[model samples]
Target: MYPDYAKKPRNVRLGLCTNDFAPHGQYGRTYSCWPIIITPYNLPPSMCMSSKYMFLTMVIPGLSNPKHLIDVYLEPLIEELLQLWHHGRKACYFDWHRQFLPEHHPYRRNKKAFTKNRIENKVARPRLTGNQPLDRVANISLAVEMPLSLPDGYSSDHKWTKKTIFWDLSYWSTLLIQHNLDVMHIEKNVFDSIFNTIMDIKGKIKDNMNAHRNLKIIWNRPELELDERRPNIMPKVVYTLVKEQKRRVCEWIRGLKFPDGYASNLPRCVDMTELRMHGMKSHDWHVFMQKLIQIAFREMLPEHVWSALTKVSLLLQRICSTTVDVHKFHELENSVSIIMCNLEKIFPPAFIDSIEHLIVHLSYEARVGGPV
Candidate 1:
């Protein structure tokens, strides 16, 4: 890693002691001496008793010119095929051909730019008579070619630029070398079950909110009740995911299910004005928030889930509703909102306000939408 890319390994290790000429009465034998430079493969003199001569294997530059690299790496597979063919096993050869042949092989004709060998030089080129460094002109050229120079819109974000370069590199690499890593094969069964479940729900559920809300039901509902046409590779795995989804969905849905214009903790259907006058006196809003949260977690929630959520509300209030300082609160708000939105779809309109208002005040400093 420490070696410079420009330095050739052989030149660095051994230098020419003499040029093509020798003095009179002397044999012109140019001796090459090894330097004290030590690599991982190099052994020290103390480690071995015998004097040794080191030979460096030269890596021809064009061998890694993308095309040759692919051939060298796949040499084992080619050797196996040659051995099979030499044995006069025509059927084995045919099977090997069918097995290893790629459907979209790019090697039939080397038309791609990557297959062609080209010199990549890091040397400086004369562009203009200038006092400025080479980088300045390069930057100016880059800016001139940018999309913003035209009338059409230009995205100047660095992230998009990096993504485009990465994708192009990946495409070229895939063409040169088939990435044989079976990514989907590793998780194929689970992936297939999830994919099938999503396809099943895609058209059947009318609303996206409903589909999102019923993610658990879509996966975990007893196999006996699921549509037979829908394929499920692992019902048990699907069932486990469904249960987890249900719990998460229910948390957010609770807030949106709260009733509107219903007097909170009020006695005997009192008038709005009377309830407001008395409600503020008796109810501590923070305490009331605690009770509502506790009611949702009737069976006592873990410190991480419940306490983490409550602390988020406090942080949100303390930070004046800015998400930068309260990333966790933002996460909690989003998670809770998904559940609440789903619950709102099924809940009666009259019952949504009280619960929704409480969650809103906890997560955000903004006042409730309507009058107090």
Candidate 2:
């Protein structure tokens, strides 16, 4: 409908536009920009649509920041819209980003006060000081205007300057909406953290042996067994692979190939040498959680733990579905909340806090049918 809308003389009104940075690999060294354009709900049902139709207008690779995003990607898009408006073909004028500002003219002048506050504290943290608004673009723009020192490692040349594009109040006042939080990235991180906590994998504080012992106890319970048969062997302690085991596991992962007609987002595993040269991707981690762990550990992981892991995997899978709606997302959130409640004893508050923050936003995004 964008082409058709561009041809129409009526004012164009976009629903919401979301933006986020995505890492190219498991390591966070390199990132890419992703911007999505969503159609307004008021439009005909045929026009407002799915992720497939969501306009992904740019893919700026390397590294970027909010300012870079506004200047490089967003500003160009806005310029095109303004052109359409000037030519009497108004493509969109929703200005979702402006909804969050106070109901007053000349709100941009509030930057001076925030700058003064920053000057006084020297090391004071920066925060949004504007009135509550639906989109945070205004607040973030204001925050950028303050004379906060750049963080270490940022080149002085890259610091904000008087000529920065986002400083143009007229341009910012017409912003489409606040950038979205990438749900996939958030879910993947939360899932990894939860899985690592349970397995007592690298970076988690839990003791692997203790985790194994708890699982063993859970699996060995009298009520859990089938009649007259001893439970299958469970690991008494977490397995630490010797050099030979490491080589074998690496070999197996490298040898893996998807069968014909199997569709996967990630490609088949590369050799260890290639993996070392090129870092792992999020899909590699997904494969690790969904398949590799079971093969590597065999019967070491108890059935109950696998059941719990399955639940987490399924939740991630369900939310990514094109047919997922607000109710389904709410169900996912409730299911995760229950999982967290039951596992609270096993996981730390800090770990649980992180996951809760991501889960809590699902309902809002679901209702809006896009990232909020």
Q: Top lDDT: which candidate number?
A: 2
Candidate 1 lDDT tens digits, 1-372: 635522322222221111122234344434222222112233344532223433322222221133434455344444433443343211111001111113333322222211122221222222222223232223332333443222211122211211122222434433322222221222222222222232223322122222223223322223223234544432232212243443443443333333554324333212222111122222323323333333433343434334433542343334333324455555544444433333232221221333233342333222111111
Model 2 CA deviation exceeding 4 Å by range: 1-141, 148-177, 191-255, 259-278, 286-299, 348-356, 370-372
Model 2 reaches what TM-score against the true structure?
0.38
The TM-score of candidate 1 is 0.17
For residues 1-372, write the lDDT of model 2, one tens digit per residue: 468554432344566566555765545655556565656554566756766445665555546555544555455556555544554421221111122223342322333212111112122123232222323323233444643333232222233223334445555444433334576577557655654444434534233222332322232322212332333432333223334544565566566677653424233434444222124466556555555555654544455555555565565556555675667676665455444333332232234444445544454455455422
Off by over 4 Å in 1: 1-283, 291-324, 353-372
Give residue 172's lDDT in candidate 2 (0 to 100). Answer: 48
